[model samples]
Target: MARFLPAIGLWGGLALVLVAVNLLIVEKQRVLDDGRTVLLALRPVDPRSLIQGDYMELRYHEALVPADAAADTASPETDGRVVVALDADGVATFRRFDDGGPLAADEQRLRYKRRAPSGLQPDPENSELFIGAESFLFQEGHAEAYEEARYGILKVAPDGSSVLAGLADSGRRPIRP
Candidate 1:
């Protein structure tokens, strides 16, 4: 029975790890599938954490949420929503206002609340759009090959929710984040 119990525990742990991996893969795919393209102007975050290595902080030009929209939908504390639109140059543009109307039928919304409570305080300095994706801050310098080749793609839904989607491949063509 003791031997059997160890084997069972090992199998259970293995199964849990597999499940976690699968979930991450699913999420990556889902973000890629649902995300749209928006040009996030690089603010270039300074390199900090001597132990962590070098990386840049990113600040987007198009970060904001209109007061009207903020009132209607629950805002995430870590991040805020911006209306993503296509610019004349065929690149994406974002506005804090909901001028784009609604997120497409197929589009999905991602909120940025690490814990419960749902609402986040909007940073007046950065405007209404707070940090929607905490993943970005951590992602700096972790993978230069991945970062250099990849571009920032944002996936947004009808209610003004959003997620940061990384470019799938080098072409910088939008695939998923």
Candidate 2:
């Protein structure tokens, strides 16, 4: 009977891992299907890597939260949410840091992570603020189609979790590549 213990343990651990992975996949799919669409103005930098193909580094215009609003000075690795007010056109602009209060009808929350600046950035003080993804990968020959992308489309859940849906043009139309 002791000989079977190792096999049982291995199979049990593998089953648990698979279940956990599937649950995560289901949660992300739910967010993508049911989350609110928010457009963030983008400042893109195109860079190519021989191994990773083509991609654009995305920087959101509204990514920086006023230093005063980020009152926690103890940790540089804090993660929090920022409230943004959506305009009629569905574009989001920074309003304030999420204070666990109710959001206004036109406002939505976005998750952000704060990290120490790498010193290579132009403005190190504000560079710590990272909102959503930093890059978007595209097929090798399709970089030109995304050159006109002016916004990074995000599907944000009610709890401030977000997924990068895609890119959009100035007119808010999704750019297909």
Candidate 3:
């Protein structure tokens, strides 16, 4: 019985790890199967981290919700959801910081996790809204291929959650495998 205790604990831990990995796989499959495809315009940003490898730091045009435009009813530092409009080309434009509610046909509600005050301050560049999927990591030697990217192909779920599916060129063709 004493020797079995360690075996039981090891199996329990292994089961937990398996469960976690399964959840991750299910979530990714959900995004790929059920998420709505939306394109977000990118303004050139290139980053290379020695430890993390080559990746592109995504800077979306809609990431900046103008200071005067974003309603400040909540505390200066808050996290919630936002509704953004999608143009004909599927590029997202900031609509409003809003309560979690239904949106119009052209709009999508996304989970807004952090409100960086310094970035949200009124400035020439305007207030920036940090949504998830800000950084996209790629293979070490694939940096050159993504340098000319102009849009982020996002698979936004119904709950306003999203995953960066891939990068797209100016012509809207996916530039990755």
Best by TM-score: 2
Per-residue lDDT of 48-130 in model 3, one digit per residue for the tens? 88899899998776454544544454524445677778888777877877665678999987665544455564432333456
> What residue pairs are clashing in model 2?
none
lDDT at position 72, candidate 2:
46
- Provide the global lDDT of candidate 2 against the true structure: 0.82
TM-scores of the models, in the given order? 0.49, 0.87, 0.82
Q: Give the number of colliding residue pairs in candidate 1.
A: 7
Winner by lDDT:
2
Query: Which ten contiguous residues of candidate 2 have the minimum total lDDT?
Result: 68-77
lDDT of 3: 0.76
Model 3 regions lying over 4 Å from their true place: 62-64, 67-77, 115-128
* Candidate 2 deviant stretches above 4 angstroms: 62-77, 119-127
**Clash totals in order:** 7, 0, 0
RMSD to true structure for each model, in Å: 7.2, 3.4, 3.9
**How does each model score on lDDT?**
0.47, 0.82, 0.76
Model 1: per-residue lDDT, tens digit, 81-156? 3444455422444434333356643333334322323344443323244435533544444554445533455665
Higher TM-score: candidate 1 or 3? 3
Better of 1 and 2 by lDDT: 2
Off by over 4 Å in 1: 62-82, 89-110, 113-129, 132-177
